[model samples]
Target chain A: MALTNHPSETPNLSFLKEKALQLRRLMLVQAAGKGQGYLGQGLGLAEFLATLYHYELRYDRDNPEWEDRDRFFLSTGHYSIALWAVLADIGYVSKESLPTYGADESPLEMSTIEGRVPGVEMTGGSLGHGLGIAVGAALGYRLSKRDARVFVEVSDGELQEGSTWEAATAANAFGLDNLVAFVDCNGIQADGAMVVPIEPVADKWRAFGWDVIEIDGNALDQVVGAMHWARMARGRPKVVVMRTKPGKGIARLEAREKAHFIRVGADEWDVIAKELEAENA
Target chain B: MLKGRTLGMGELERIEDRPFRTAPFAAGTLAAATRCDRLAVLTADLGKYTDVHPFRDAHPDRFFNVGMAEQALVSVAAGLAKTGWTAYCTTYGAFATRRAHDFLAIACAHGGAAVKMFAGNPGLTTGYGGTHQAIEDLALMRAIPDVTVIDPCDATEMQQIAEQAIDIPGTVYCRLLRGNVPVVLDPATYRFEVGKATRFGEGGDVGFVSTGFMTERCLDAARKLETQGVRASVLHVGTIKPFDAAAVAEFAGSVTRLVTAENHVLVGGLTSLVLDAMQEAQILRPMLKIGIPDRFIECGSVPYLQDKYGLTAARVHERVAAWLDRSGTSAAA
Candidate 1:
């Protein structure tokens, strides 16, 4: 309880709740601008991204490349809608440029390219690379003798990649306590309904020598609590298996059969935006 | 009471009539690390084969062994480079390219990470067949934009690249010739430079442009050709990607015809580079490629494979003499 980072100091639940809604609204705006996107996954990840950007992560808002700043590596690059929305909220990205997402000659590519975007530590989207990069960055922190941590966001579907396990093995072998992985267990993938089986996910991570913290990812309290638990954990890396619902905030989007990518018609953008606002209101 | 067994080693063959240096990579790296404050060496359980054990013993805190995961090995190095550490990684060329190519392509190549990959057993150097050999490493690595590709001739060039490649920006992939490597090039006369080719011998009839340990073979073939009144010149191309196009074109212009050789496939290795260089330089020269064919190589001893694949110096000399006789070109002409 005595560890003094932003997570403990900013125990204001209401602020984080507002930030989560705001992230959803901004994500809707970005997706609506492009007329379509991986809106379902982005909507589901709003709560976690809100928790990370507003509470857990430590970064200089003025300088994204600050050497000692805590990093938040978005492993699934298709989830750039969520990152764009959150960083825009943090003022790291200009809110006016939100419409240019996924457009031609846009810095806001559907997938992240590291230096092109600020606040993005690694260019993700090629599944199974985030954990290893986070582990290396954590080791770099130790080598440089800094206290800044490395936080990574991965999906349950990404576990199917063998390289992810290789990274998981190395993370435990190196004993990277400064690294925390948040796996979004959203139950669906590109080929529909998680084609490969990754059940007993918590047990697998536990066997891989990590402190496992499972939580209902849409719930802000549990997300914050898991962050606190991971912050206090010592001597081993941590994995917070976040069981999230795709397209969580809006009912119409959630009820759709294909929630992996929410391709809404142009006329439906206003309705979805209003629905998102009404849910929080 | 333990039973000893021979470790299945790759590419332990050495060139004759030259001074040998033990673990020149380690010696060269130690010297480089002395000057740089933030240099670290890493390997994926192949530390014994890579000769990084000496560096590991000297600076234990700076060494990392990330099990046998090649993808993780390259990804971790890219991550380390992102955080301001020049990471040096060593692994079999097969695993480094075939297995971890995506990691290297996206993580290191796209981001411009300052990681150095010392790929061992490149082309047909390994006796472990296709599974362990890196047959098309030159073509694969050279295609990746902004990455420096190198294949040193011997111990002298290997040691020099080890020191110089530290300061080379972005990423680098070099064919590692280690464990009592032959000293074909004299450091006093031959200096290794990035994207620079060095020429040897006084013969102007046949120009042999070669890379890797095949440079030694070319020099030997040149000596063999010289005794038969056919003077031949040998051009050693150390760096393959930032290729010495100007040197290759100039060398092509000077000689009557060209013989491009490497320990790799002729499709996209040194032969491709020379063709590209001549095209840009607009110099048309009759070129003969002496190297591995486009197919899967079989498992055999190093000498047997070298002789079978036409990579030996005698085979190269025989091929060049035959080509000259067919073309009706000699030293008298």
Candidate 2:
């Protein structure tokens, strides 16, 4: 109903790239205090999130809960490692709370809890619920004639959850073009590899009547371009399947055999930090 | 207090050709939506079955049918709440709890979403066998943190709850009685208050703490008890969570004995809550719990199932008389 599909001027690609590097750095700093976390997924999602928070989403840091603002849902709550980093960078949460992540009584929980942070629209971690919630929000927004878009980030591992398909079916049934689902296909799960086969991810979404786009998630330009295309209200929900390496920025972490949960040696913090900085430079 | 034009498992013993409110859930929810502009009614493909067709027909723009996906039904309601819509959804109680328990837990209740869920076929109200009978829905819904659990007793309470549950903060899971429902309480004198119980008659001999439409049976049992010289009082506890413990304790303290009856299992239901309340008050009164036993119930007519499971008024009265005689307590009027 509210169709503003015009493409905007090019976003500063270099700036977005540097912001991705900063996100990776902050992720390491948060993981360093605990020495163990969901770092691999966090590292892989830096560019995807950086492009989203820094450029794509229309939100106000001053009024994080501005009712009509674009909403971002984190379906993979374990990626709070990346969410906290991005929110902190955007001033929604304090940078000082980064070290306390995954700590007891911390607002920045290991997973995304809705009430803990104002920016977190939903409590995620118990997989396969965010997309449906997004669908509801998109429907409500459209009903009220609000043009703000709903963006939700999920994972390939989460695709195995049956509720995900249920939500997928409903979104297409409602013809919710205002909703966009980013499937962060990192190809790893808590039990090493995917316990269930969720291959042909884009085709699966297409089967559900979604407008599908498959891209290299780490590529910032592609992320922006995909978002640009997703802006058009094409009378169907959209999904972007982003195939990304588990650990993208650094070679040592990227080459790890099992990267679901990363635990660094107490002495390896400085080395990993240098690896990230050197690669970006 | 008898209803007419009944069908299926809703048939009662005293059915007569009298006026009755048909589809009270649909009528009440439609009325509530008319007043609240922010209200949206959705059903998981059980619109007519769950008696939500009135809301669907009256407010077409505000109604959404999400096929038969119970999980999405709940999550989408929660999501709708996030975007500032009070979503009142309906489905079979069995599916709302057993199928979408996780969605209700993490997505709806955890976030304190304004998703008012109406569960049709509460307890043994359905003849659709184990899969459709939501016998443990009250217990399952009550266990969720910050959830308002309600069991409306009749057409009056069903209509009242639809108007009231929206104002109840956080999420609400109400057990609804739909289709040719009996009106037990007078709407003029009764108001559906959360965390409160309604007392029928001030008899001091025996007080029955009951909920759901089982209160109707308890009322009938009380009248039968009166003829046998036992003055029986019925305390209708509609809200299971944020339970009216004070009322239970007060009612327990006054009566010589207590009887907690419901259409659900004995465990974690009204009986368990009554015991907890009495225990908390440190009152060691002899109590009788009348309800279904632990097992999957088979498909049958309401009267047959109620008779088989000892939930009918005749069974309730017989059980109480036995309890009184065995205890050697004088059930004086």
Candidate 3:
């Protein structure tokens, strides 16, 4: 909730780096307890979420429904664990709601946006639905001539949903400059590799009429630069293809294929905790 | 008292200047409407078909055309509502109910997102054949909880209710029958509350309860019943879900026989709503249902199917007469 020289001054890269590390740690804790969560996605997307929450997104932790605030929608609902960690780290949610991650009664379900977490928007777990919602919000802001922007985060695999393309085409056709789409190209899904071959992802976005930008998602500078370019690009919607590893923070998990859902034994968890401590150190 | 309005083609042209042709828009006319400037409109290439074109023209920035994708149409509308914008998504009933029902149920209703969905040509109002006609929309839409389903009798009612949908803070699935329907209810004399019933006629021996476009036909049926010494009452049920069970049950219990009709599949629509209300009120009355049987209606002119499905006034008369004759009931008591 602290404002220092309007989001770009001094660019607190160190603080953002610390936040990303904290997000990975929280995600690891939730994954350790449940034996699963979208830990790989949360870990992979930690840097992007950290940069957006810290420097880009204009949100109020106290009032999530503040009318003129910027809007962010997670098109890929399965990645809520990563989102939850970033939200908690930013004081958007109570620390007590953290451990009840996948519990039945908890509003912090595995993948749902119940407005409980400040700045969390839209209840989305279904693929292909979030883009349309984001487009709608962006359209709303433009209509009201509000400075609020809309950011939608999607996965590489989720591009298969027809609704995503439908909404993408619409956003471009409408020339919605206030909308930004972040495609997390982590190269793995429930089945296997994305597209079965190397895809010209940025070119594809450009062809679809979007102002496309690509970056190393794990790198905080590139992520921030791409976001800045997105904000600067006018008269067209923008998309950032963030190339990232499935699990970035933990080495053993990053090397494994099924790291999509990790289950480390108690001894292995102690190793994860030690690695997290080393990262902090 | 909805009485004596011109019917047939040239309906939209006739009422273009007449204010309050759509309910959601009419709700905007009154100053007492909700200040939720989150009021945005989304249409799937149906800006004119669903009669939201006026709103689009008036508030260009607040209007969106999502092209022909009905599924994305509702999904996006739900998303906008989640972000504190009161969004109204419009499309044809066939597409809105059949193509986008899952999104309507999950993204909009189950998600607890306050969005309004308006569809044109619910039932047989569309003369454009089977594809455009929403014979099963009520059947599909009524099953979702927290979804307020409405089928305005005519353009006047549509205008009035459309305005209310904007101010209302919940999800509403309303049928939009374009152009001139037989304007049977007056906007002044008869109140158009979302969950209330409108009494169209009064009689004793039989009652004709209907919703949507059939309310007018039921009035004609009541007129014919009068000449035959069979005094029939008519209850116009505009709101299908969160149905007016008390009025329906009270009428069904009081009348000798109750007949329900609509231009839809005989399941999950007006008849089903009335039947459920009967059960809830524990009124075991003999009821005859008049509607499209369980089958995919073949594409044709609206008149062709109306004759085939016995949705005409003459058929209603004959069916009611037959039921009354079989029971040997009279209103003399």
Candidate 4:
């Protein structure tokens, strides 16, 4: 009964775009401040987070624990920097929180602090977990006859975990139409590309009885369109394969594996700041 | 004990009046009633064995049997949890502990996925041999930081604890059994409370703290000891994760000798928990462990293995007496 379907009035797209840029800036700064972070992963996932928090997700910014709101699970915990940037940009936490990325004492431990991070539905770090939790949440909503959707952000490498497929099989079997999974198919994992290749990802999802869609994740409109279609799909759960570029906005990091782990020197902070400002301009 | 409940296989077949039982099945029912929208029932081709078939039948749209893949069983449950579903994945205890530990620990527990696992044939309940027995489940689950562990005494406790599991914030791995479960504790005498030990008998000579199916045999041993004018205390501990060291230590400090009984390996589970508690509380009494040794048990009858492993009432009585004699404590007359 605590679950609700009271949708909020749509916000302006211009504002969301600005928020995305700000999030990118925050993430870049956090990575630079730490001298190292999962900058590449966060960059790749920035647009997905932007589209979710800004336009698609049903959440109460002021009251993160609102029972009826959509549950967003980030299964790959290394992308905490990206998630932190999104949370800060969307006012889930203050922008000031960004400086503490990878700090020893901060509550932000470089892992997605599920439930603790205002909009994060579950804690994530260990891969292959979100799908089950999201499955449970979707079932909870369905049992209550609520229309709230559950969205899980899974990485390409995470699919190697048998648990993700387990959830996928069950989601289809259960006809969880309200559940959606956003896969960041950036190709790169901890050690080079995922083994055995994860291409034709959409085909695999469709074979598992899901309503699958593929989109260029960096494009805001495409991301939004996929979300719209996913919401409209009936019966089967939806999976949006987001093809993204690692280290998206930063030109230098975009091509380097260093984007995967960019460690900025203390003396190079000024140079990095200047470059970020130029990119923003 | 509750009887005459049938175990249904899938959507197609139904077995009649078999007296099905398990903690997760009972908990699944309560969860089904409470989180009606977000709750889902899942099994790894083990709907009847783990006793989740009832929930599946009631909520067909919300129930799924994901074939016989144990790793997939928990992962899919974790995925459902990710997508806003509170999924209960059930399977045999042996499969859960040995096969899908990564899913149970990382995906469900460490990932903070709200997935519940109901493992069947926990610690010698199956009588089906080593392949089915879950002697190391508690040890496997104990390593996860945020996961909750439960071992119900019988059908009544199973039913009550099932409802209580929803209150636990993260992944829960519960020992389960199905069909014709016996009632070990009176409903009026003991209430279902996770993390709290239930003291069934009072005594000062020796105390037996146990978990899983072995608790039932230990209680019987306590009764047998009483008939011989020996007052032995019996404590049933169902929750093993946040192992209640303080309570175990207090009981150990008061008793002349201590013993731990479980249907699991003595290296981990009840015996290990008791030793850990004693070490932490600094109460090192002459402790005797009554359970399977650190070796795979050969296929045999349930009673035979119980006797072979010293898990029967007679063995418990004999072991407690031996320990008492060594400790120079006389039986209460």
Q: How accurate locally is residue A70 in candidate 3, as Cα lDDT from 0 to 100?
A: 81
Displacement of the residue A274 alpha carbon in candidate 3, Å: 2.1
Could you tell me every candidate's TM-score relative to the true structure? 0.96, 0.96, 0.91, 0.84
Worst 10 residues of 3 chain A by lDDT: A1-10
Indicate whether candidate 2 or candidate 3 has the larger DockQ.
Answer: 2
DockQ of each: 0.73, 0.85, 0.51, 0.33
* Model 4 spans with C-alpha error above 4 angstroms: A1-17, A269-281, B1-41, B57-66, B69-89, B99-116, B127-130, B163-171, B200-203, B226-231, B241-247, B279-284, B318-333
RMSD of each: 3.2, 3.0, 4.4, 5.6
Cα error of candidate 2 at position A77, Å: 0.6
Model 2 CA lDDT for position A63 = 80
Lowest summed lDDT across 10 adjacent residues in model 2 chain A is found at A1-10
Measured as a fraction from 0 to 1, the native contacts recovered by model 4 come to 0.56
- Sort by DockQ, best first: 2, 1, 3, 4
Docking class of 3: medium
Candidate 1 global lDDT: 0.87
Candidate 1 backbone collisions, by pair: A77-A125
lDDT of 1 by residue, A1-281 (tens): 21223555557789889999998888888888888888899889988998888788888777777787887888899999999999899887998888888889988888888888788778897998988888788877777788988898899999998988998998899888999999999999998999988999999999999999899999999998988888864789999999999998999998888988778899988898888888888
List where candidate 2 sits over 4 angstroms from the true fold. Answer: A1-7, B1-14, B17-19, B329-333
Candidate 4, residues A144-256: lDDT per residue as tens digits? 77778888889888888877887788788778888899999988887776666787889989999998889999887788788778777588899999999987877766778
